[model samples]
Target: MTAPVRTRSSEDLIRAEEPVLAHNYHPLPVVVSRAEGVWVEDVEGRRYLDLLAGYSALNFGHRHPALIAAAHEQLDRLTLTSRAFHNDRLAEFAERLAGLVGLDMVLPMNTGAEAVESGIKVARKWAYDVKGVPADRATIVVAAENFHGRTTTIVGFSTDETARAGFGPFAPGFRIVPYNDLAALEAAVDETTAAVLIEPIQGEAGVIIPDEGYLTGVRELTRRTGCLFVADEIQSGLGRTGRTLAVDHESVVPDVLLLGKALGGGIVPVSAVVANRDVLGVLGPGEHGSTFGGNPLAAAVGTAVVDLLETGEFQRRAAELGAVLRDGLTGLVGKGVVGFRSRGLWAGVDVDPALGTGREVSARLMGEGVLVKDTHGSTIRLAPPLTITEDELLNALATLGRVLERSV
Candidate 1:
């Protein structure tokens, strides 16, 4: 007696799932059965190069051995402690992560949205307690086209009509200013302003890079106005952009840094809001926390992730490999690509209207054995794992070149 051989039926499975799953994600129909490093195999046993790396959450690559071992070991010892009591793994992870981010304190959470929310709370508290702002009058300036998260309050502040349309009565006190516009930012902030929340690179907005010196100028402005500068590096942080944090490219130290995504090492959800004693200390015991926020299992995985990033090995890999990927993409800039932008291992190429739509091109790439996703309308983002070998990246680039040529 033996288990029956499982015939490949991923396409059928995905089609069946179209009715059961939420419609929020308009995913391409390829059903992934397995992933290793920068490659993924469908249930049919056909492999496609993974160019998105789980939207940067797989920066350490799919199931890196160390992370898997760490997760396994933690599962054996403990899973969740509910945050009612301290867990052994939590403190060590916090201290190590604090040091890694060069921050005086760390507040752990489970998702990037939680980290952003924590930053908001900390800023508001600081505004009330330290800055002596009037109650409920504190305003946080956000950039246009920002995608913080999908939470109600987060969405309330979003500028994208698709993300915010008909969802209001939006949250009060959020001023939307233009991204990368220093003058607009300056004009928007006032004495009642609590924080300026921004992403160093707009990952969700098609890897849009800010103008040169934009981050530096924001840092200077935040410092001058006494407003807390919060960098939501959930997507651009953790070696995704070749730097430990995208702000590093401009040598700017934000008042509060929000980190998530790959910090979990592609295994568990780990997010943190890092700041000094003065900024983060605003929250006393009863004010904030999560049951699974800083639990032992997540802490364990996060610790391993910190260890991986602390070595700077992954950063170097992303930096070097990203250059190669970008170089290859440059060849498409004037061809079927209407625009192209990238930082580190991540790239966004907008297909020309003369070419097929991004969705059509993405489906075509999937057929050609390269898995990537389209963002916005005509933009496809390529974010291969940082662990991807030069040869694999080159091969993926060659595949993309073929797709671009055929798409037109």
Candidate 2:
């Protein structure tokens, strides 16, 4: 039997989705049909340099050969065991991931938000069982304008009105303090504080990097206050920021590390909470578990990801290419760019309002065969895949410069 051929354009697909799919996201009009490395082809066969890189989920680029091969091999074997019975792949995955991050244990999950939620639970449990904090008085200190995840509990303490509006009545036991302010953080922590949760580099808040020694201060303060330090590296870790972990830049180690995004190698959804036994050990049998967590398929892909990072090739690429990116963006400072904050190849560029809003600039760039995403009013993030070649990256930057000039 022959299958019926379909002839729907990108506009048709977009229109078709509007009525049936949820309107939670306002994505760009481009409908990608295929991708490889740092380039994606839309439904109509137009190619664009992917500067956004799936918001760091594609840190290794789309359909990396090694990652795809691992996935294919795993699919041929076992796919899922539902955490009911032990799988052969889980142990090595856990061990390699833990060793790569210098942690003692790994609690695998499917998404970044789930890893965050699990970290919260682990911190609270450790507070009661180990730290001797009172049952109901455990509090976690978080930074203002931080982007951890979008769960109901995670959003409960968010300072952003858009994220929290009408999503309450909310959970308590979270204290918000100004980010990068050691004094404010110290003032907020007390006997009831169970942990201080923070993003080593605030990704959603426009890649906001803290002042020097801020993470170090966080470690010292958490240690002195008898509380755990949890670094939400879901967006900043696993070679996204030219290091195995962003905290490595400061030589600081948090008690708990939340990892996601690149963990699944851009092929599947894989996230994990890495911590020492003292912190994650607080969980007992039946306390918390995920049916698909630590499944064999995720394990295989995650192990492959760890293998890639172990060679330090991606980390080196991000570091070396980061210099080029910094220079390119710096040259645009007096052009249409106002300023930017960058570490490694990841950057948040502030477009001059006189030119246009970030969204407008992004749309124009898309027309110029480049792809980027806007965050705030006049800010766009750039995090190209580490696998992008020097020529490709420079070409994207040149396109960005041209787009800005045209906008003006």
Using lDDT, give the best candidate's number: 2
Tell me the RMSD of model 1 versus the true structure: 2.1
- Per model, state how many residue pairs clash: 0, 0
- Superposed by TM-score, candidate 2 places the C-alpha of residue 174 at a distance from the truth, in angstroms, of 0.3
CA lDDT of every candidate:
0.88, 0.93
Q: State the lDDT of candidate 1 residue by residue for 210-264, as single tens digits.
A: 9989999999998999989999999999888888999999889898999998988
Instruction: Summarize candidate 2's per-residue lDDT along 1-408 as a digit string, tens digits.
Output: 122233578899999999999998999899887888888887777888999988899999999999999999999999999888999999999999999999899999999999999999999999999989988999999999988888899999888889999889888999999999999999999998999999999998899999999999999999998999999999999998899999999999899999999999898899999999988988988999999899999999999999999999999999999999999999999889999999998999999998988899899999888999999889999999999899988998999899888888
- Give TM per candidate: 0.97, 0.98
How well does candidate 2 match the true structure in TM-score terms? 0.98
lDDT score at residue 348, model 1, on the 0-100 scale: 87
Residue 327 error, candidate 2, Å: 0.4
